[model samples]
Target chain A: MTGTEPTADETPTTRSIPAVAVVDAQTPGNVGTIARAMKNFGFEELLLVDPPELDPDGEAYGFAGHAREDVLPNAQEISFDELVSSYHTIGCTAVTNEGDHNHVRFPFSTPRDLAQRLPTVDADTAIVFGREGVGLTNDELARIDEICSIPASADYPVLNLGQAATITLYELREMTLSPAGTQLPDLERVRASQPLLERLYDQWDELLVEINHPEEKREKTARMIRRVFGRADPTTREVNTFLGVLRRATERPDQEE
Target chain B: MTGTEPTADETPTTRSIPAVAVVDAQTPGNVGTIARAMKNFGFEELLLVDPPELDPDGEAYGFAGHAREDVLPNAQEISFDELVSSYHTIGCTAVTNEGDHNHVRFPFSTPRDLAQRLPTVDADTAIVFGREGVGLTNDELARIDEICSIPASADYPVLNLGQAATITLYELREMTLSPAGTQLPDLERVRASQPLLERLYDQWDELLVEINHPEEKREKTARMIRRVFGRADPTTREVNTFLGVLRRATERPDQEE
Candidate 1:
């Protein structure tokens, strides 16, 4: 399933894909935490919008761990307007917050939903995480195109800055890397058609009755056979083989020995 | 959708729920970051299995944010054996790692898969995350019932300690809080049956032809109409309304006024 960890040779240049921007972020530790998450999910660019004097030497790097050199030093400090013009900005907000009534934050997509939508777009995208205190203000939210939020417990729907960033990036990375519509391997057999599957099930149902399976259980046993086959998603050839076995079992009802 | 941020009266006591255990966790900030994530996801208990001296006054609390009061103080330090005895331990690992041949890590479930399985188990559970560097050794992994790993880019599948914890806890909490099989609201309209939808599409297809919607574009236009309506998943009543509107429009032929 992991198709071998994409070597340096396989991993394409990741810059200009989707940048992560933190607007008026309060804590340096959170920024450091965000940087670590960015690296985990294969995102490189970090944008700090209108700002704070970050402890580049201290908290930011300290918390960043291995990602310090890759994400922290190169993080760009830009005004909110600068970020808006360069990329399609997606504002992040909590759905249960007071801002839910606010038009700008009303239609919030879950991170997974946003991730699914992002791969179809070829444009450079920026997922902006709001401040630590109250999140993005009305003015800041207005500048973005769409809003994305992680679905959390309604009681404490709001996630910490780092946690939100990590979850969002994780979903984005997983989705972007392996799209939901990804095709299966060519070697894997195609599933049998509906009519053939129905025939197979019919044979199994008859066999169950011939075996004197409990009258009450005949229907359920037949249904379970359908479910197991459905989950297997067997090829036409496999289905035919199974049907043959059932046909033999039905024909030789006295061959229980 | 977020039902008024469940009131304190509605909030369930979360003391003995599924806990998070950090085994020999090296960084103080990662622990703090993890605590904040735990609180974000409504998970309360924390077990530190032979962890380092955490910065109680400094980094741990500072990074914990709002979760400091709830999760940090009550965190208990216990031996690995005690953790194994107390709960159904789930080891977290990376898929791209070299432990595929190992029994515990080979058939690792994704957090989503693990979450679905957890609700069926009546026993207390503990999801154990390994150290920041090399994840749980083979010896430690063998002690757990099952392994859970986040699907990440093969190029860099290893995530930072806190980010890994945050993502895992996020999925677990989201699933535990809102199981996928939960019924939708009663107000939600039931979708139209397949035959009804097919008939509606056939009518629309004929209407498209009558309107002379660019002879070459007729098929595409009809298909697009089907796609649009298909996505809306209209109720039987709504489908009838749309069919009636289409029927009238087709019959009028020349209703320019």
Candidate 2:
């Protein structure tokens, strides 16, 4: 399931490519703040790659304020490679269109521009934000289909991750003419559902080992599975597909070693 | 020494006309916040007209943040009549472009556009924000030379006075290109100066009493006076020349009175 491409039945019109992503994020405070911003803008799918510092109770609560449940606990955490491999139309926040992928910079895209583009893609879209201090490496930006930048002072070109997220989500939400599109619950409901990720993680770890990959490849393989679920944000059918994929991988019979 | 038109000898370049005016703005928090915003965008002048609610200490500190002293005491309190009679170009913050005043930045200027226009006007460019809840009255707007709007969501566009001020100033500051320009005040030294505007206010009030006729007309007279000074952030020479006019008025016996 992780390696498979979309089949014939995949709906191209449901463009769920999100308007935000956090890459190698280091702070839970920023994550929570970004979540609040996402909630405000009505975008729930949050993607994080290689987040090293995560404290749900301490930082996320403080930053999220009134809207925590809007944050997906199943926020897929994967490596840089898997993230690029999964998405068809990912925009990086680091470089602009003028910049080359090796010197990658996300070109400045107004929220209105992204809002218009979001609904057209066949696959999930990703808006990627980089780590707190250093931005996305040029190599990482290479995989992004669009590179957009927020025009800021050259004196201090970078925005605080939360502020950047807030502005993007706010703009997109502003463009949302349909008020009833997605009804978001409060923080408590989201927290109640976080345990689902923990359970899924346990199941995934078991399948990773049974695939009988070399020790060096086990973590890498497990991470790719995380990536697929992370970017796809699978609905019931997709989630079921993942479960079947895991079941088949583990149930395969081989000579006992 | 608070009001005067430009003299023939003065060659002009560069002006900072603020976009929001809080005439006789009642809330101290709002006032301080406006001051803080002015300081944020390098705007030092503020005009007040008939404010019944002002607690200098509590508000100046909170809104101005690190630059409390930047709130000039004279700007802290000025008669509306004085502002009106003094300014050559008093631009109101009107949401509409239908009025007589030509070329008001409508549909809002990008922060960059406003910044580019800053250097073209003379010293007397004023951005007038209205009171806390209800904005400036239509009659008040009708009298101004022009109107300026800071674009925001039409759904509920009223920005908290401070937040609105902050965004305006932030946009201007961001638009500033620092190279070849003199260095701005180091972060530590941007405190609001109170004494200069305070001294100017003393002279202005006395002038109002001098030029001010009929007790019934005194308050209305004051509002107009404030509007003038609000637009013309008079220089020291300009203030002194205007003061001389007022002093002479007081020294002479009025023929009618």
Q: Write one digit per residue (lDDT tens) for candidate 2, span B1-257.
A: 22334466765444435433467666676676566555534566677776645556675554444346655454645555656666643443425443212223222233335556655544565566777556676667666654445433333334444444554555555333353221221121111233544565566667667665677877776677767665444444445565676666766645557
Local distance difference test, candidate 1:
0.76
Tens-digit per-residue lDDT, A119-162, candidate 2? 54446566778876666766767677665554444333445565
Q: What is the TM-score of each candidate against the true structure?
A: 0.63, 0.41
What Cα-based lDDT does every candidate model obtain? 0.76, 0.54
Chain B TM-score, one value per candidate, order as shown: 0.63, 0.54
Query: Please, what are the lDDT tens digits per residue for candidate 1 over residues B183-236?
Result: 212122346799999989988987887777788888778788889888766667
Docking class of 1: incorrect
Candidate 2's error at B53, in angstroms?
A: 24
Which stretch of 10 consecutive residues in model 2 chain B shows the poorest summed lDDT? B182-191
Clashes of 1: 0
Give the deviation of candidate 1 from the true structure as CA RMSD.
Answer: 14.3
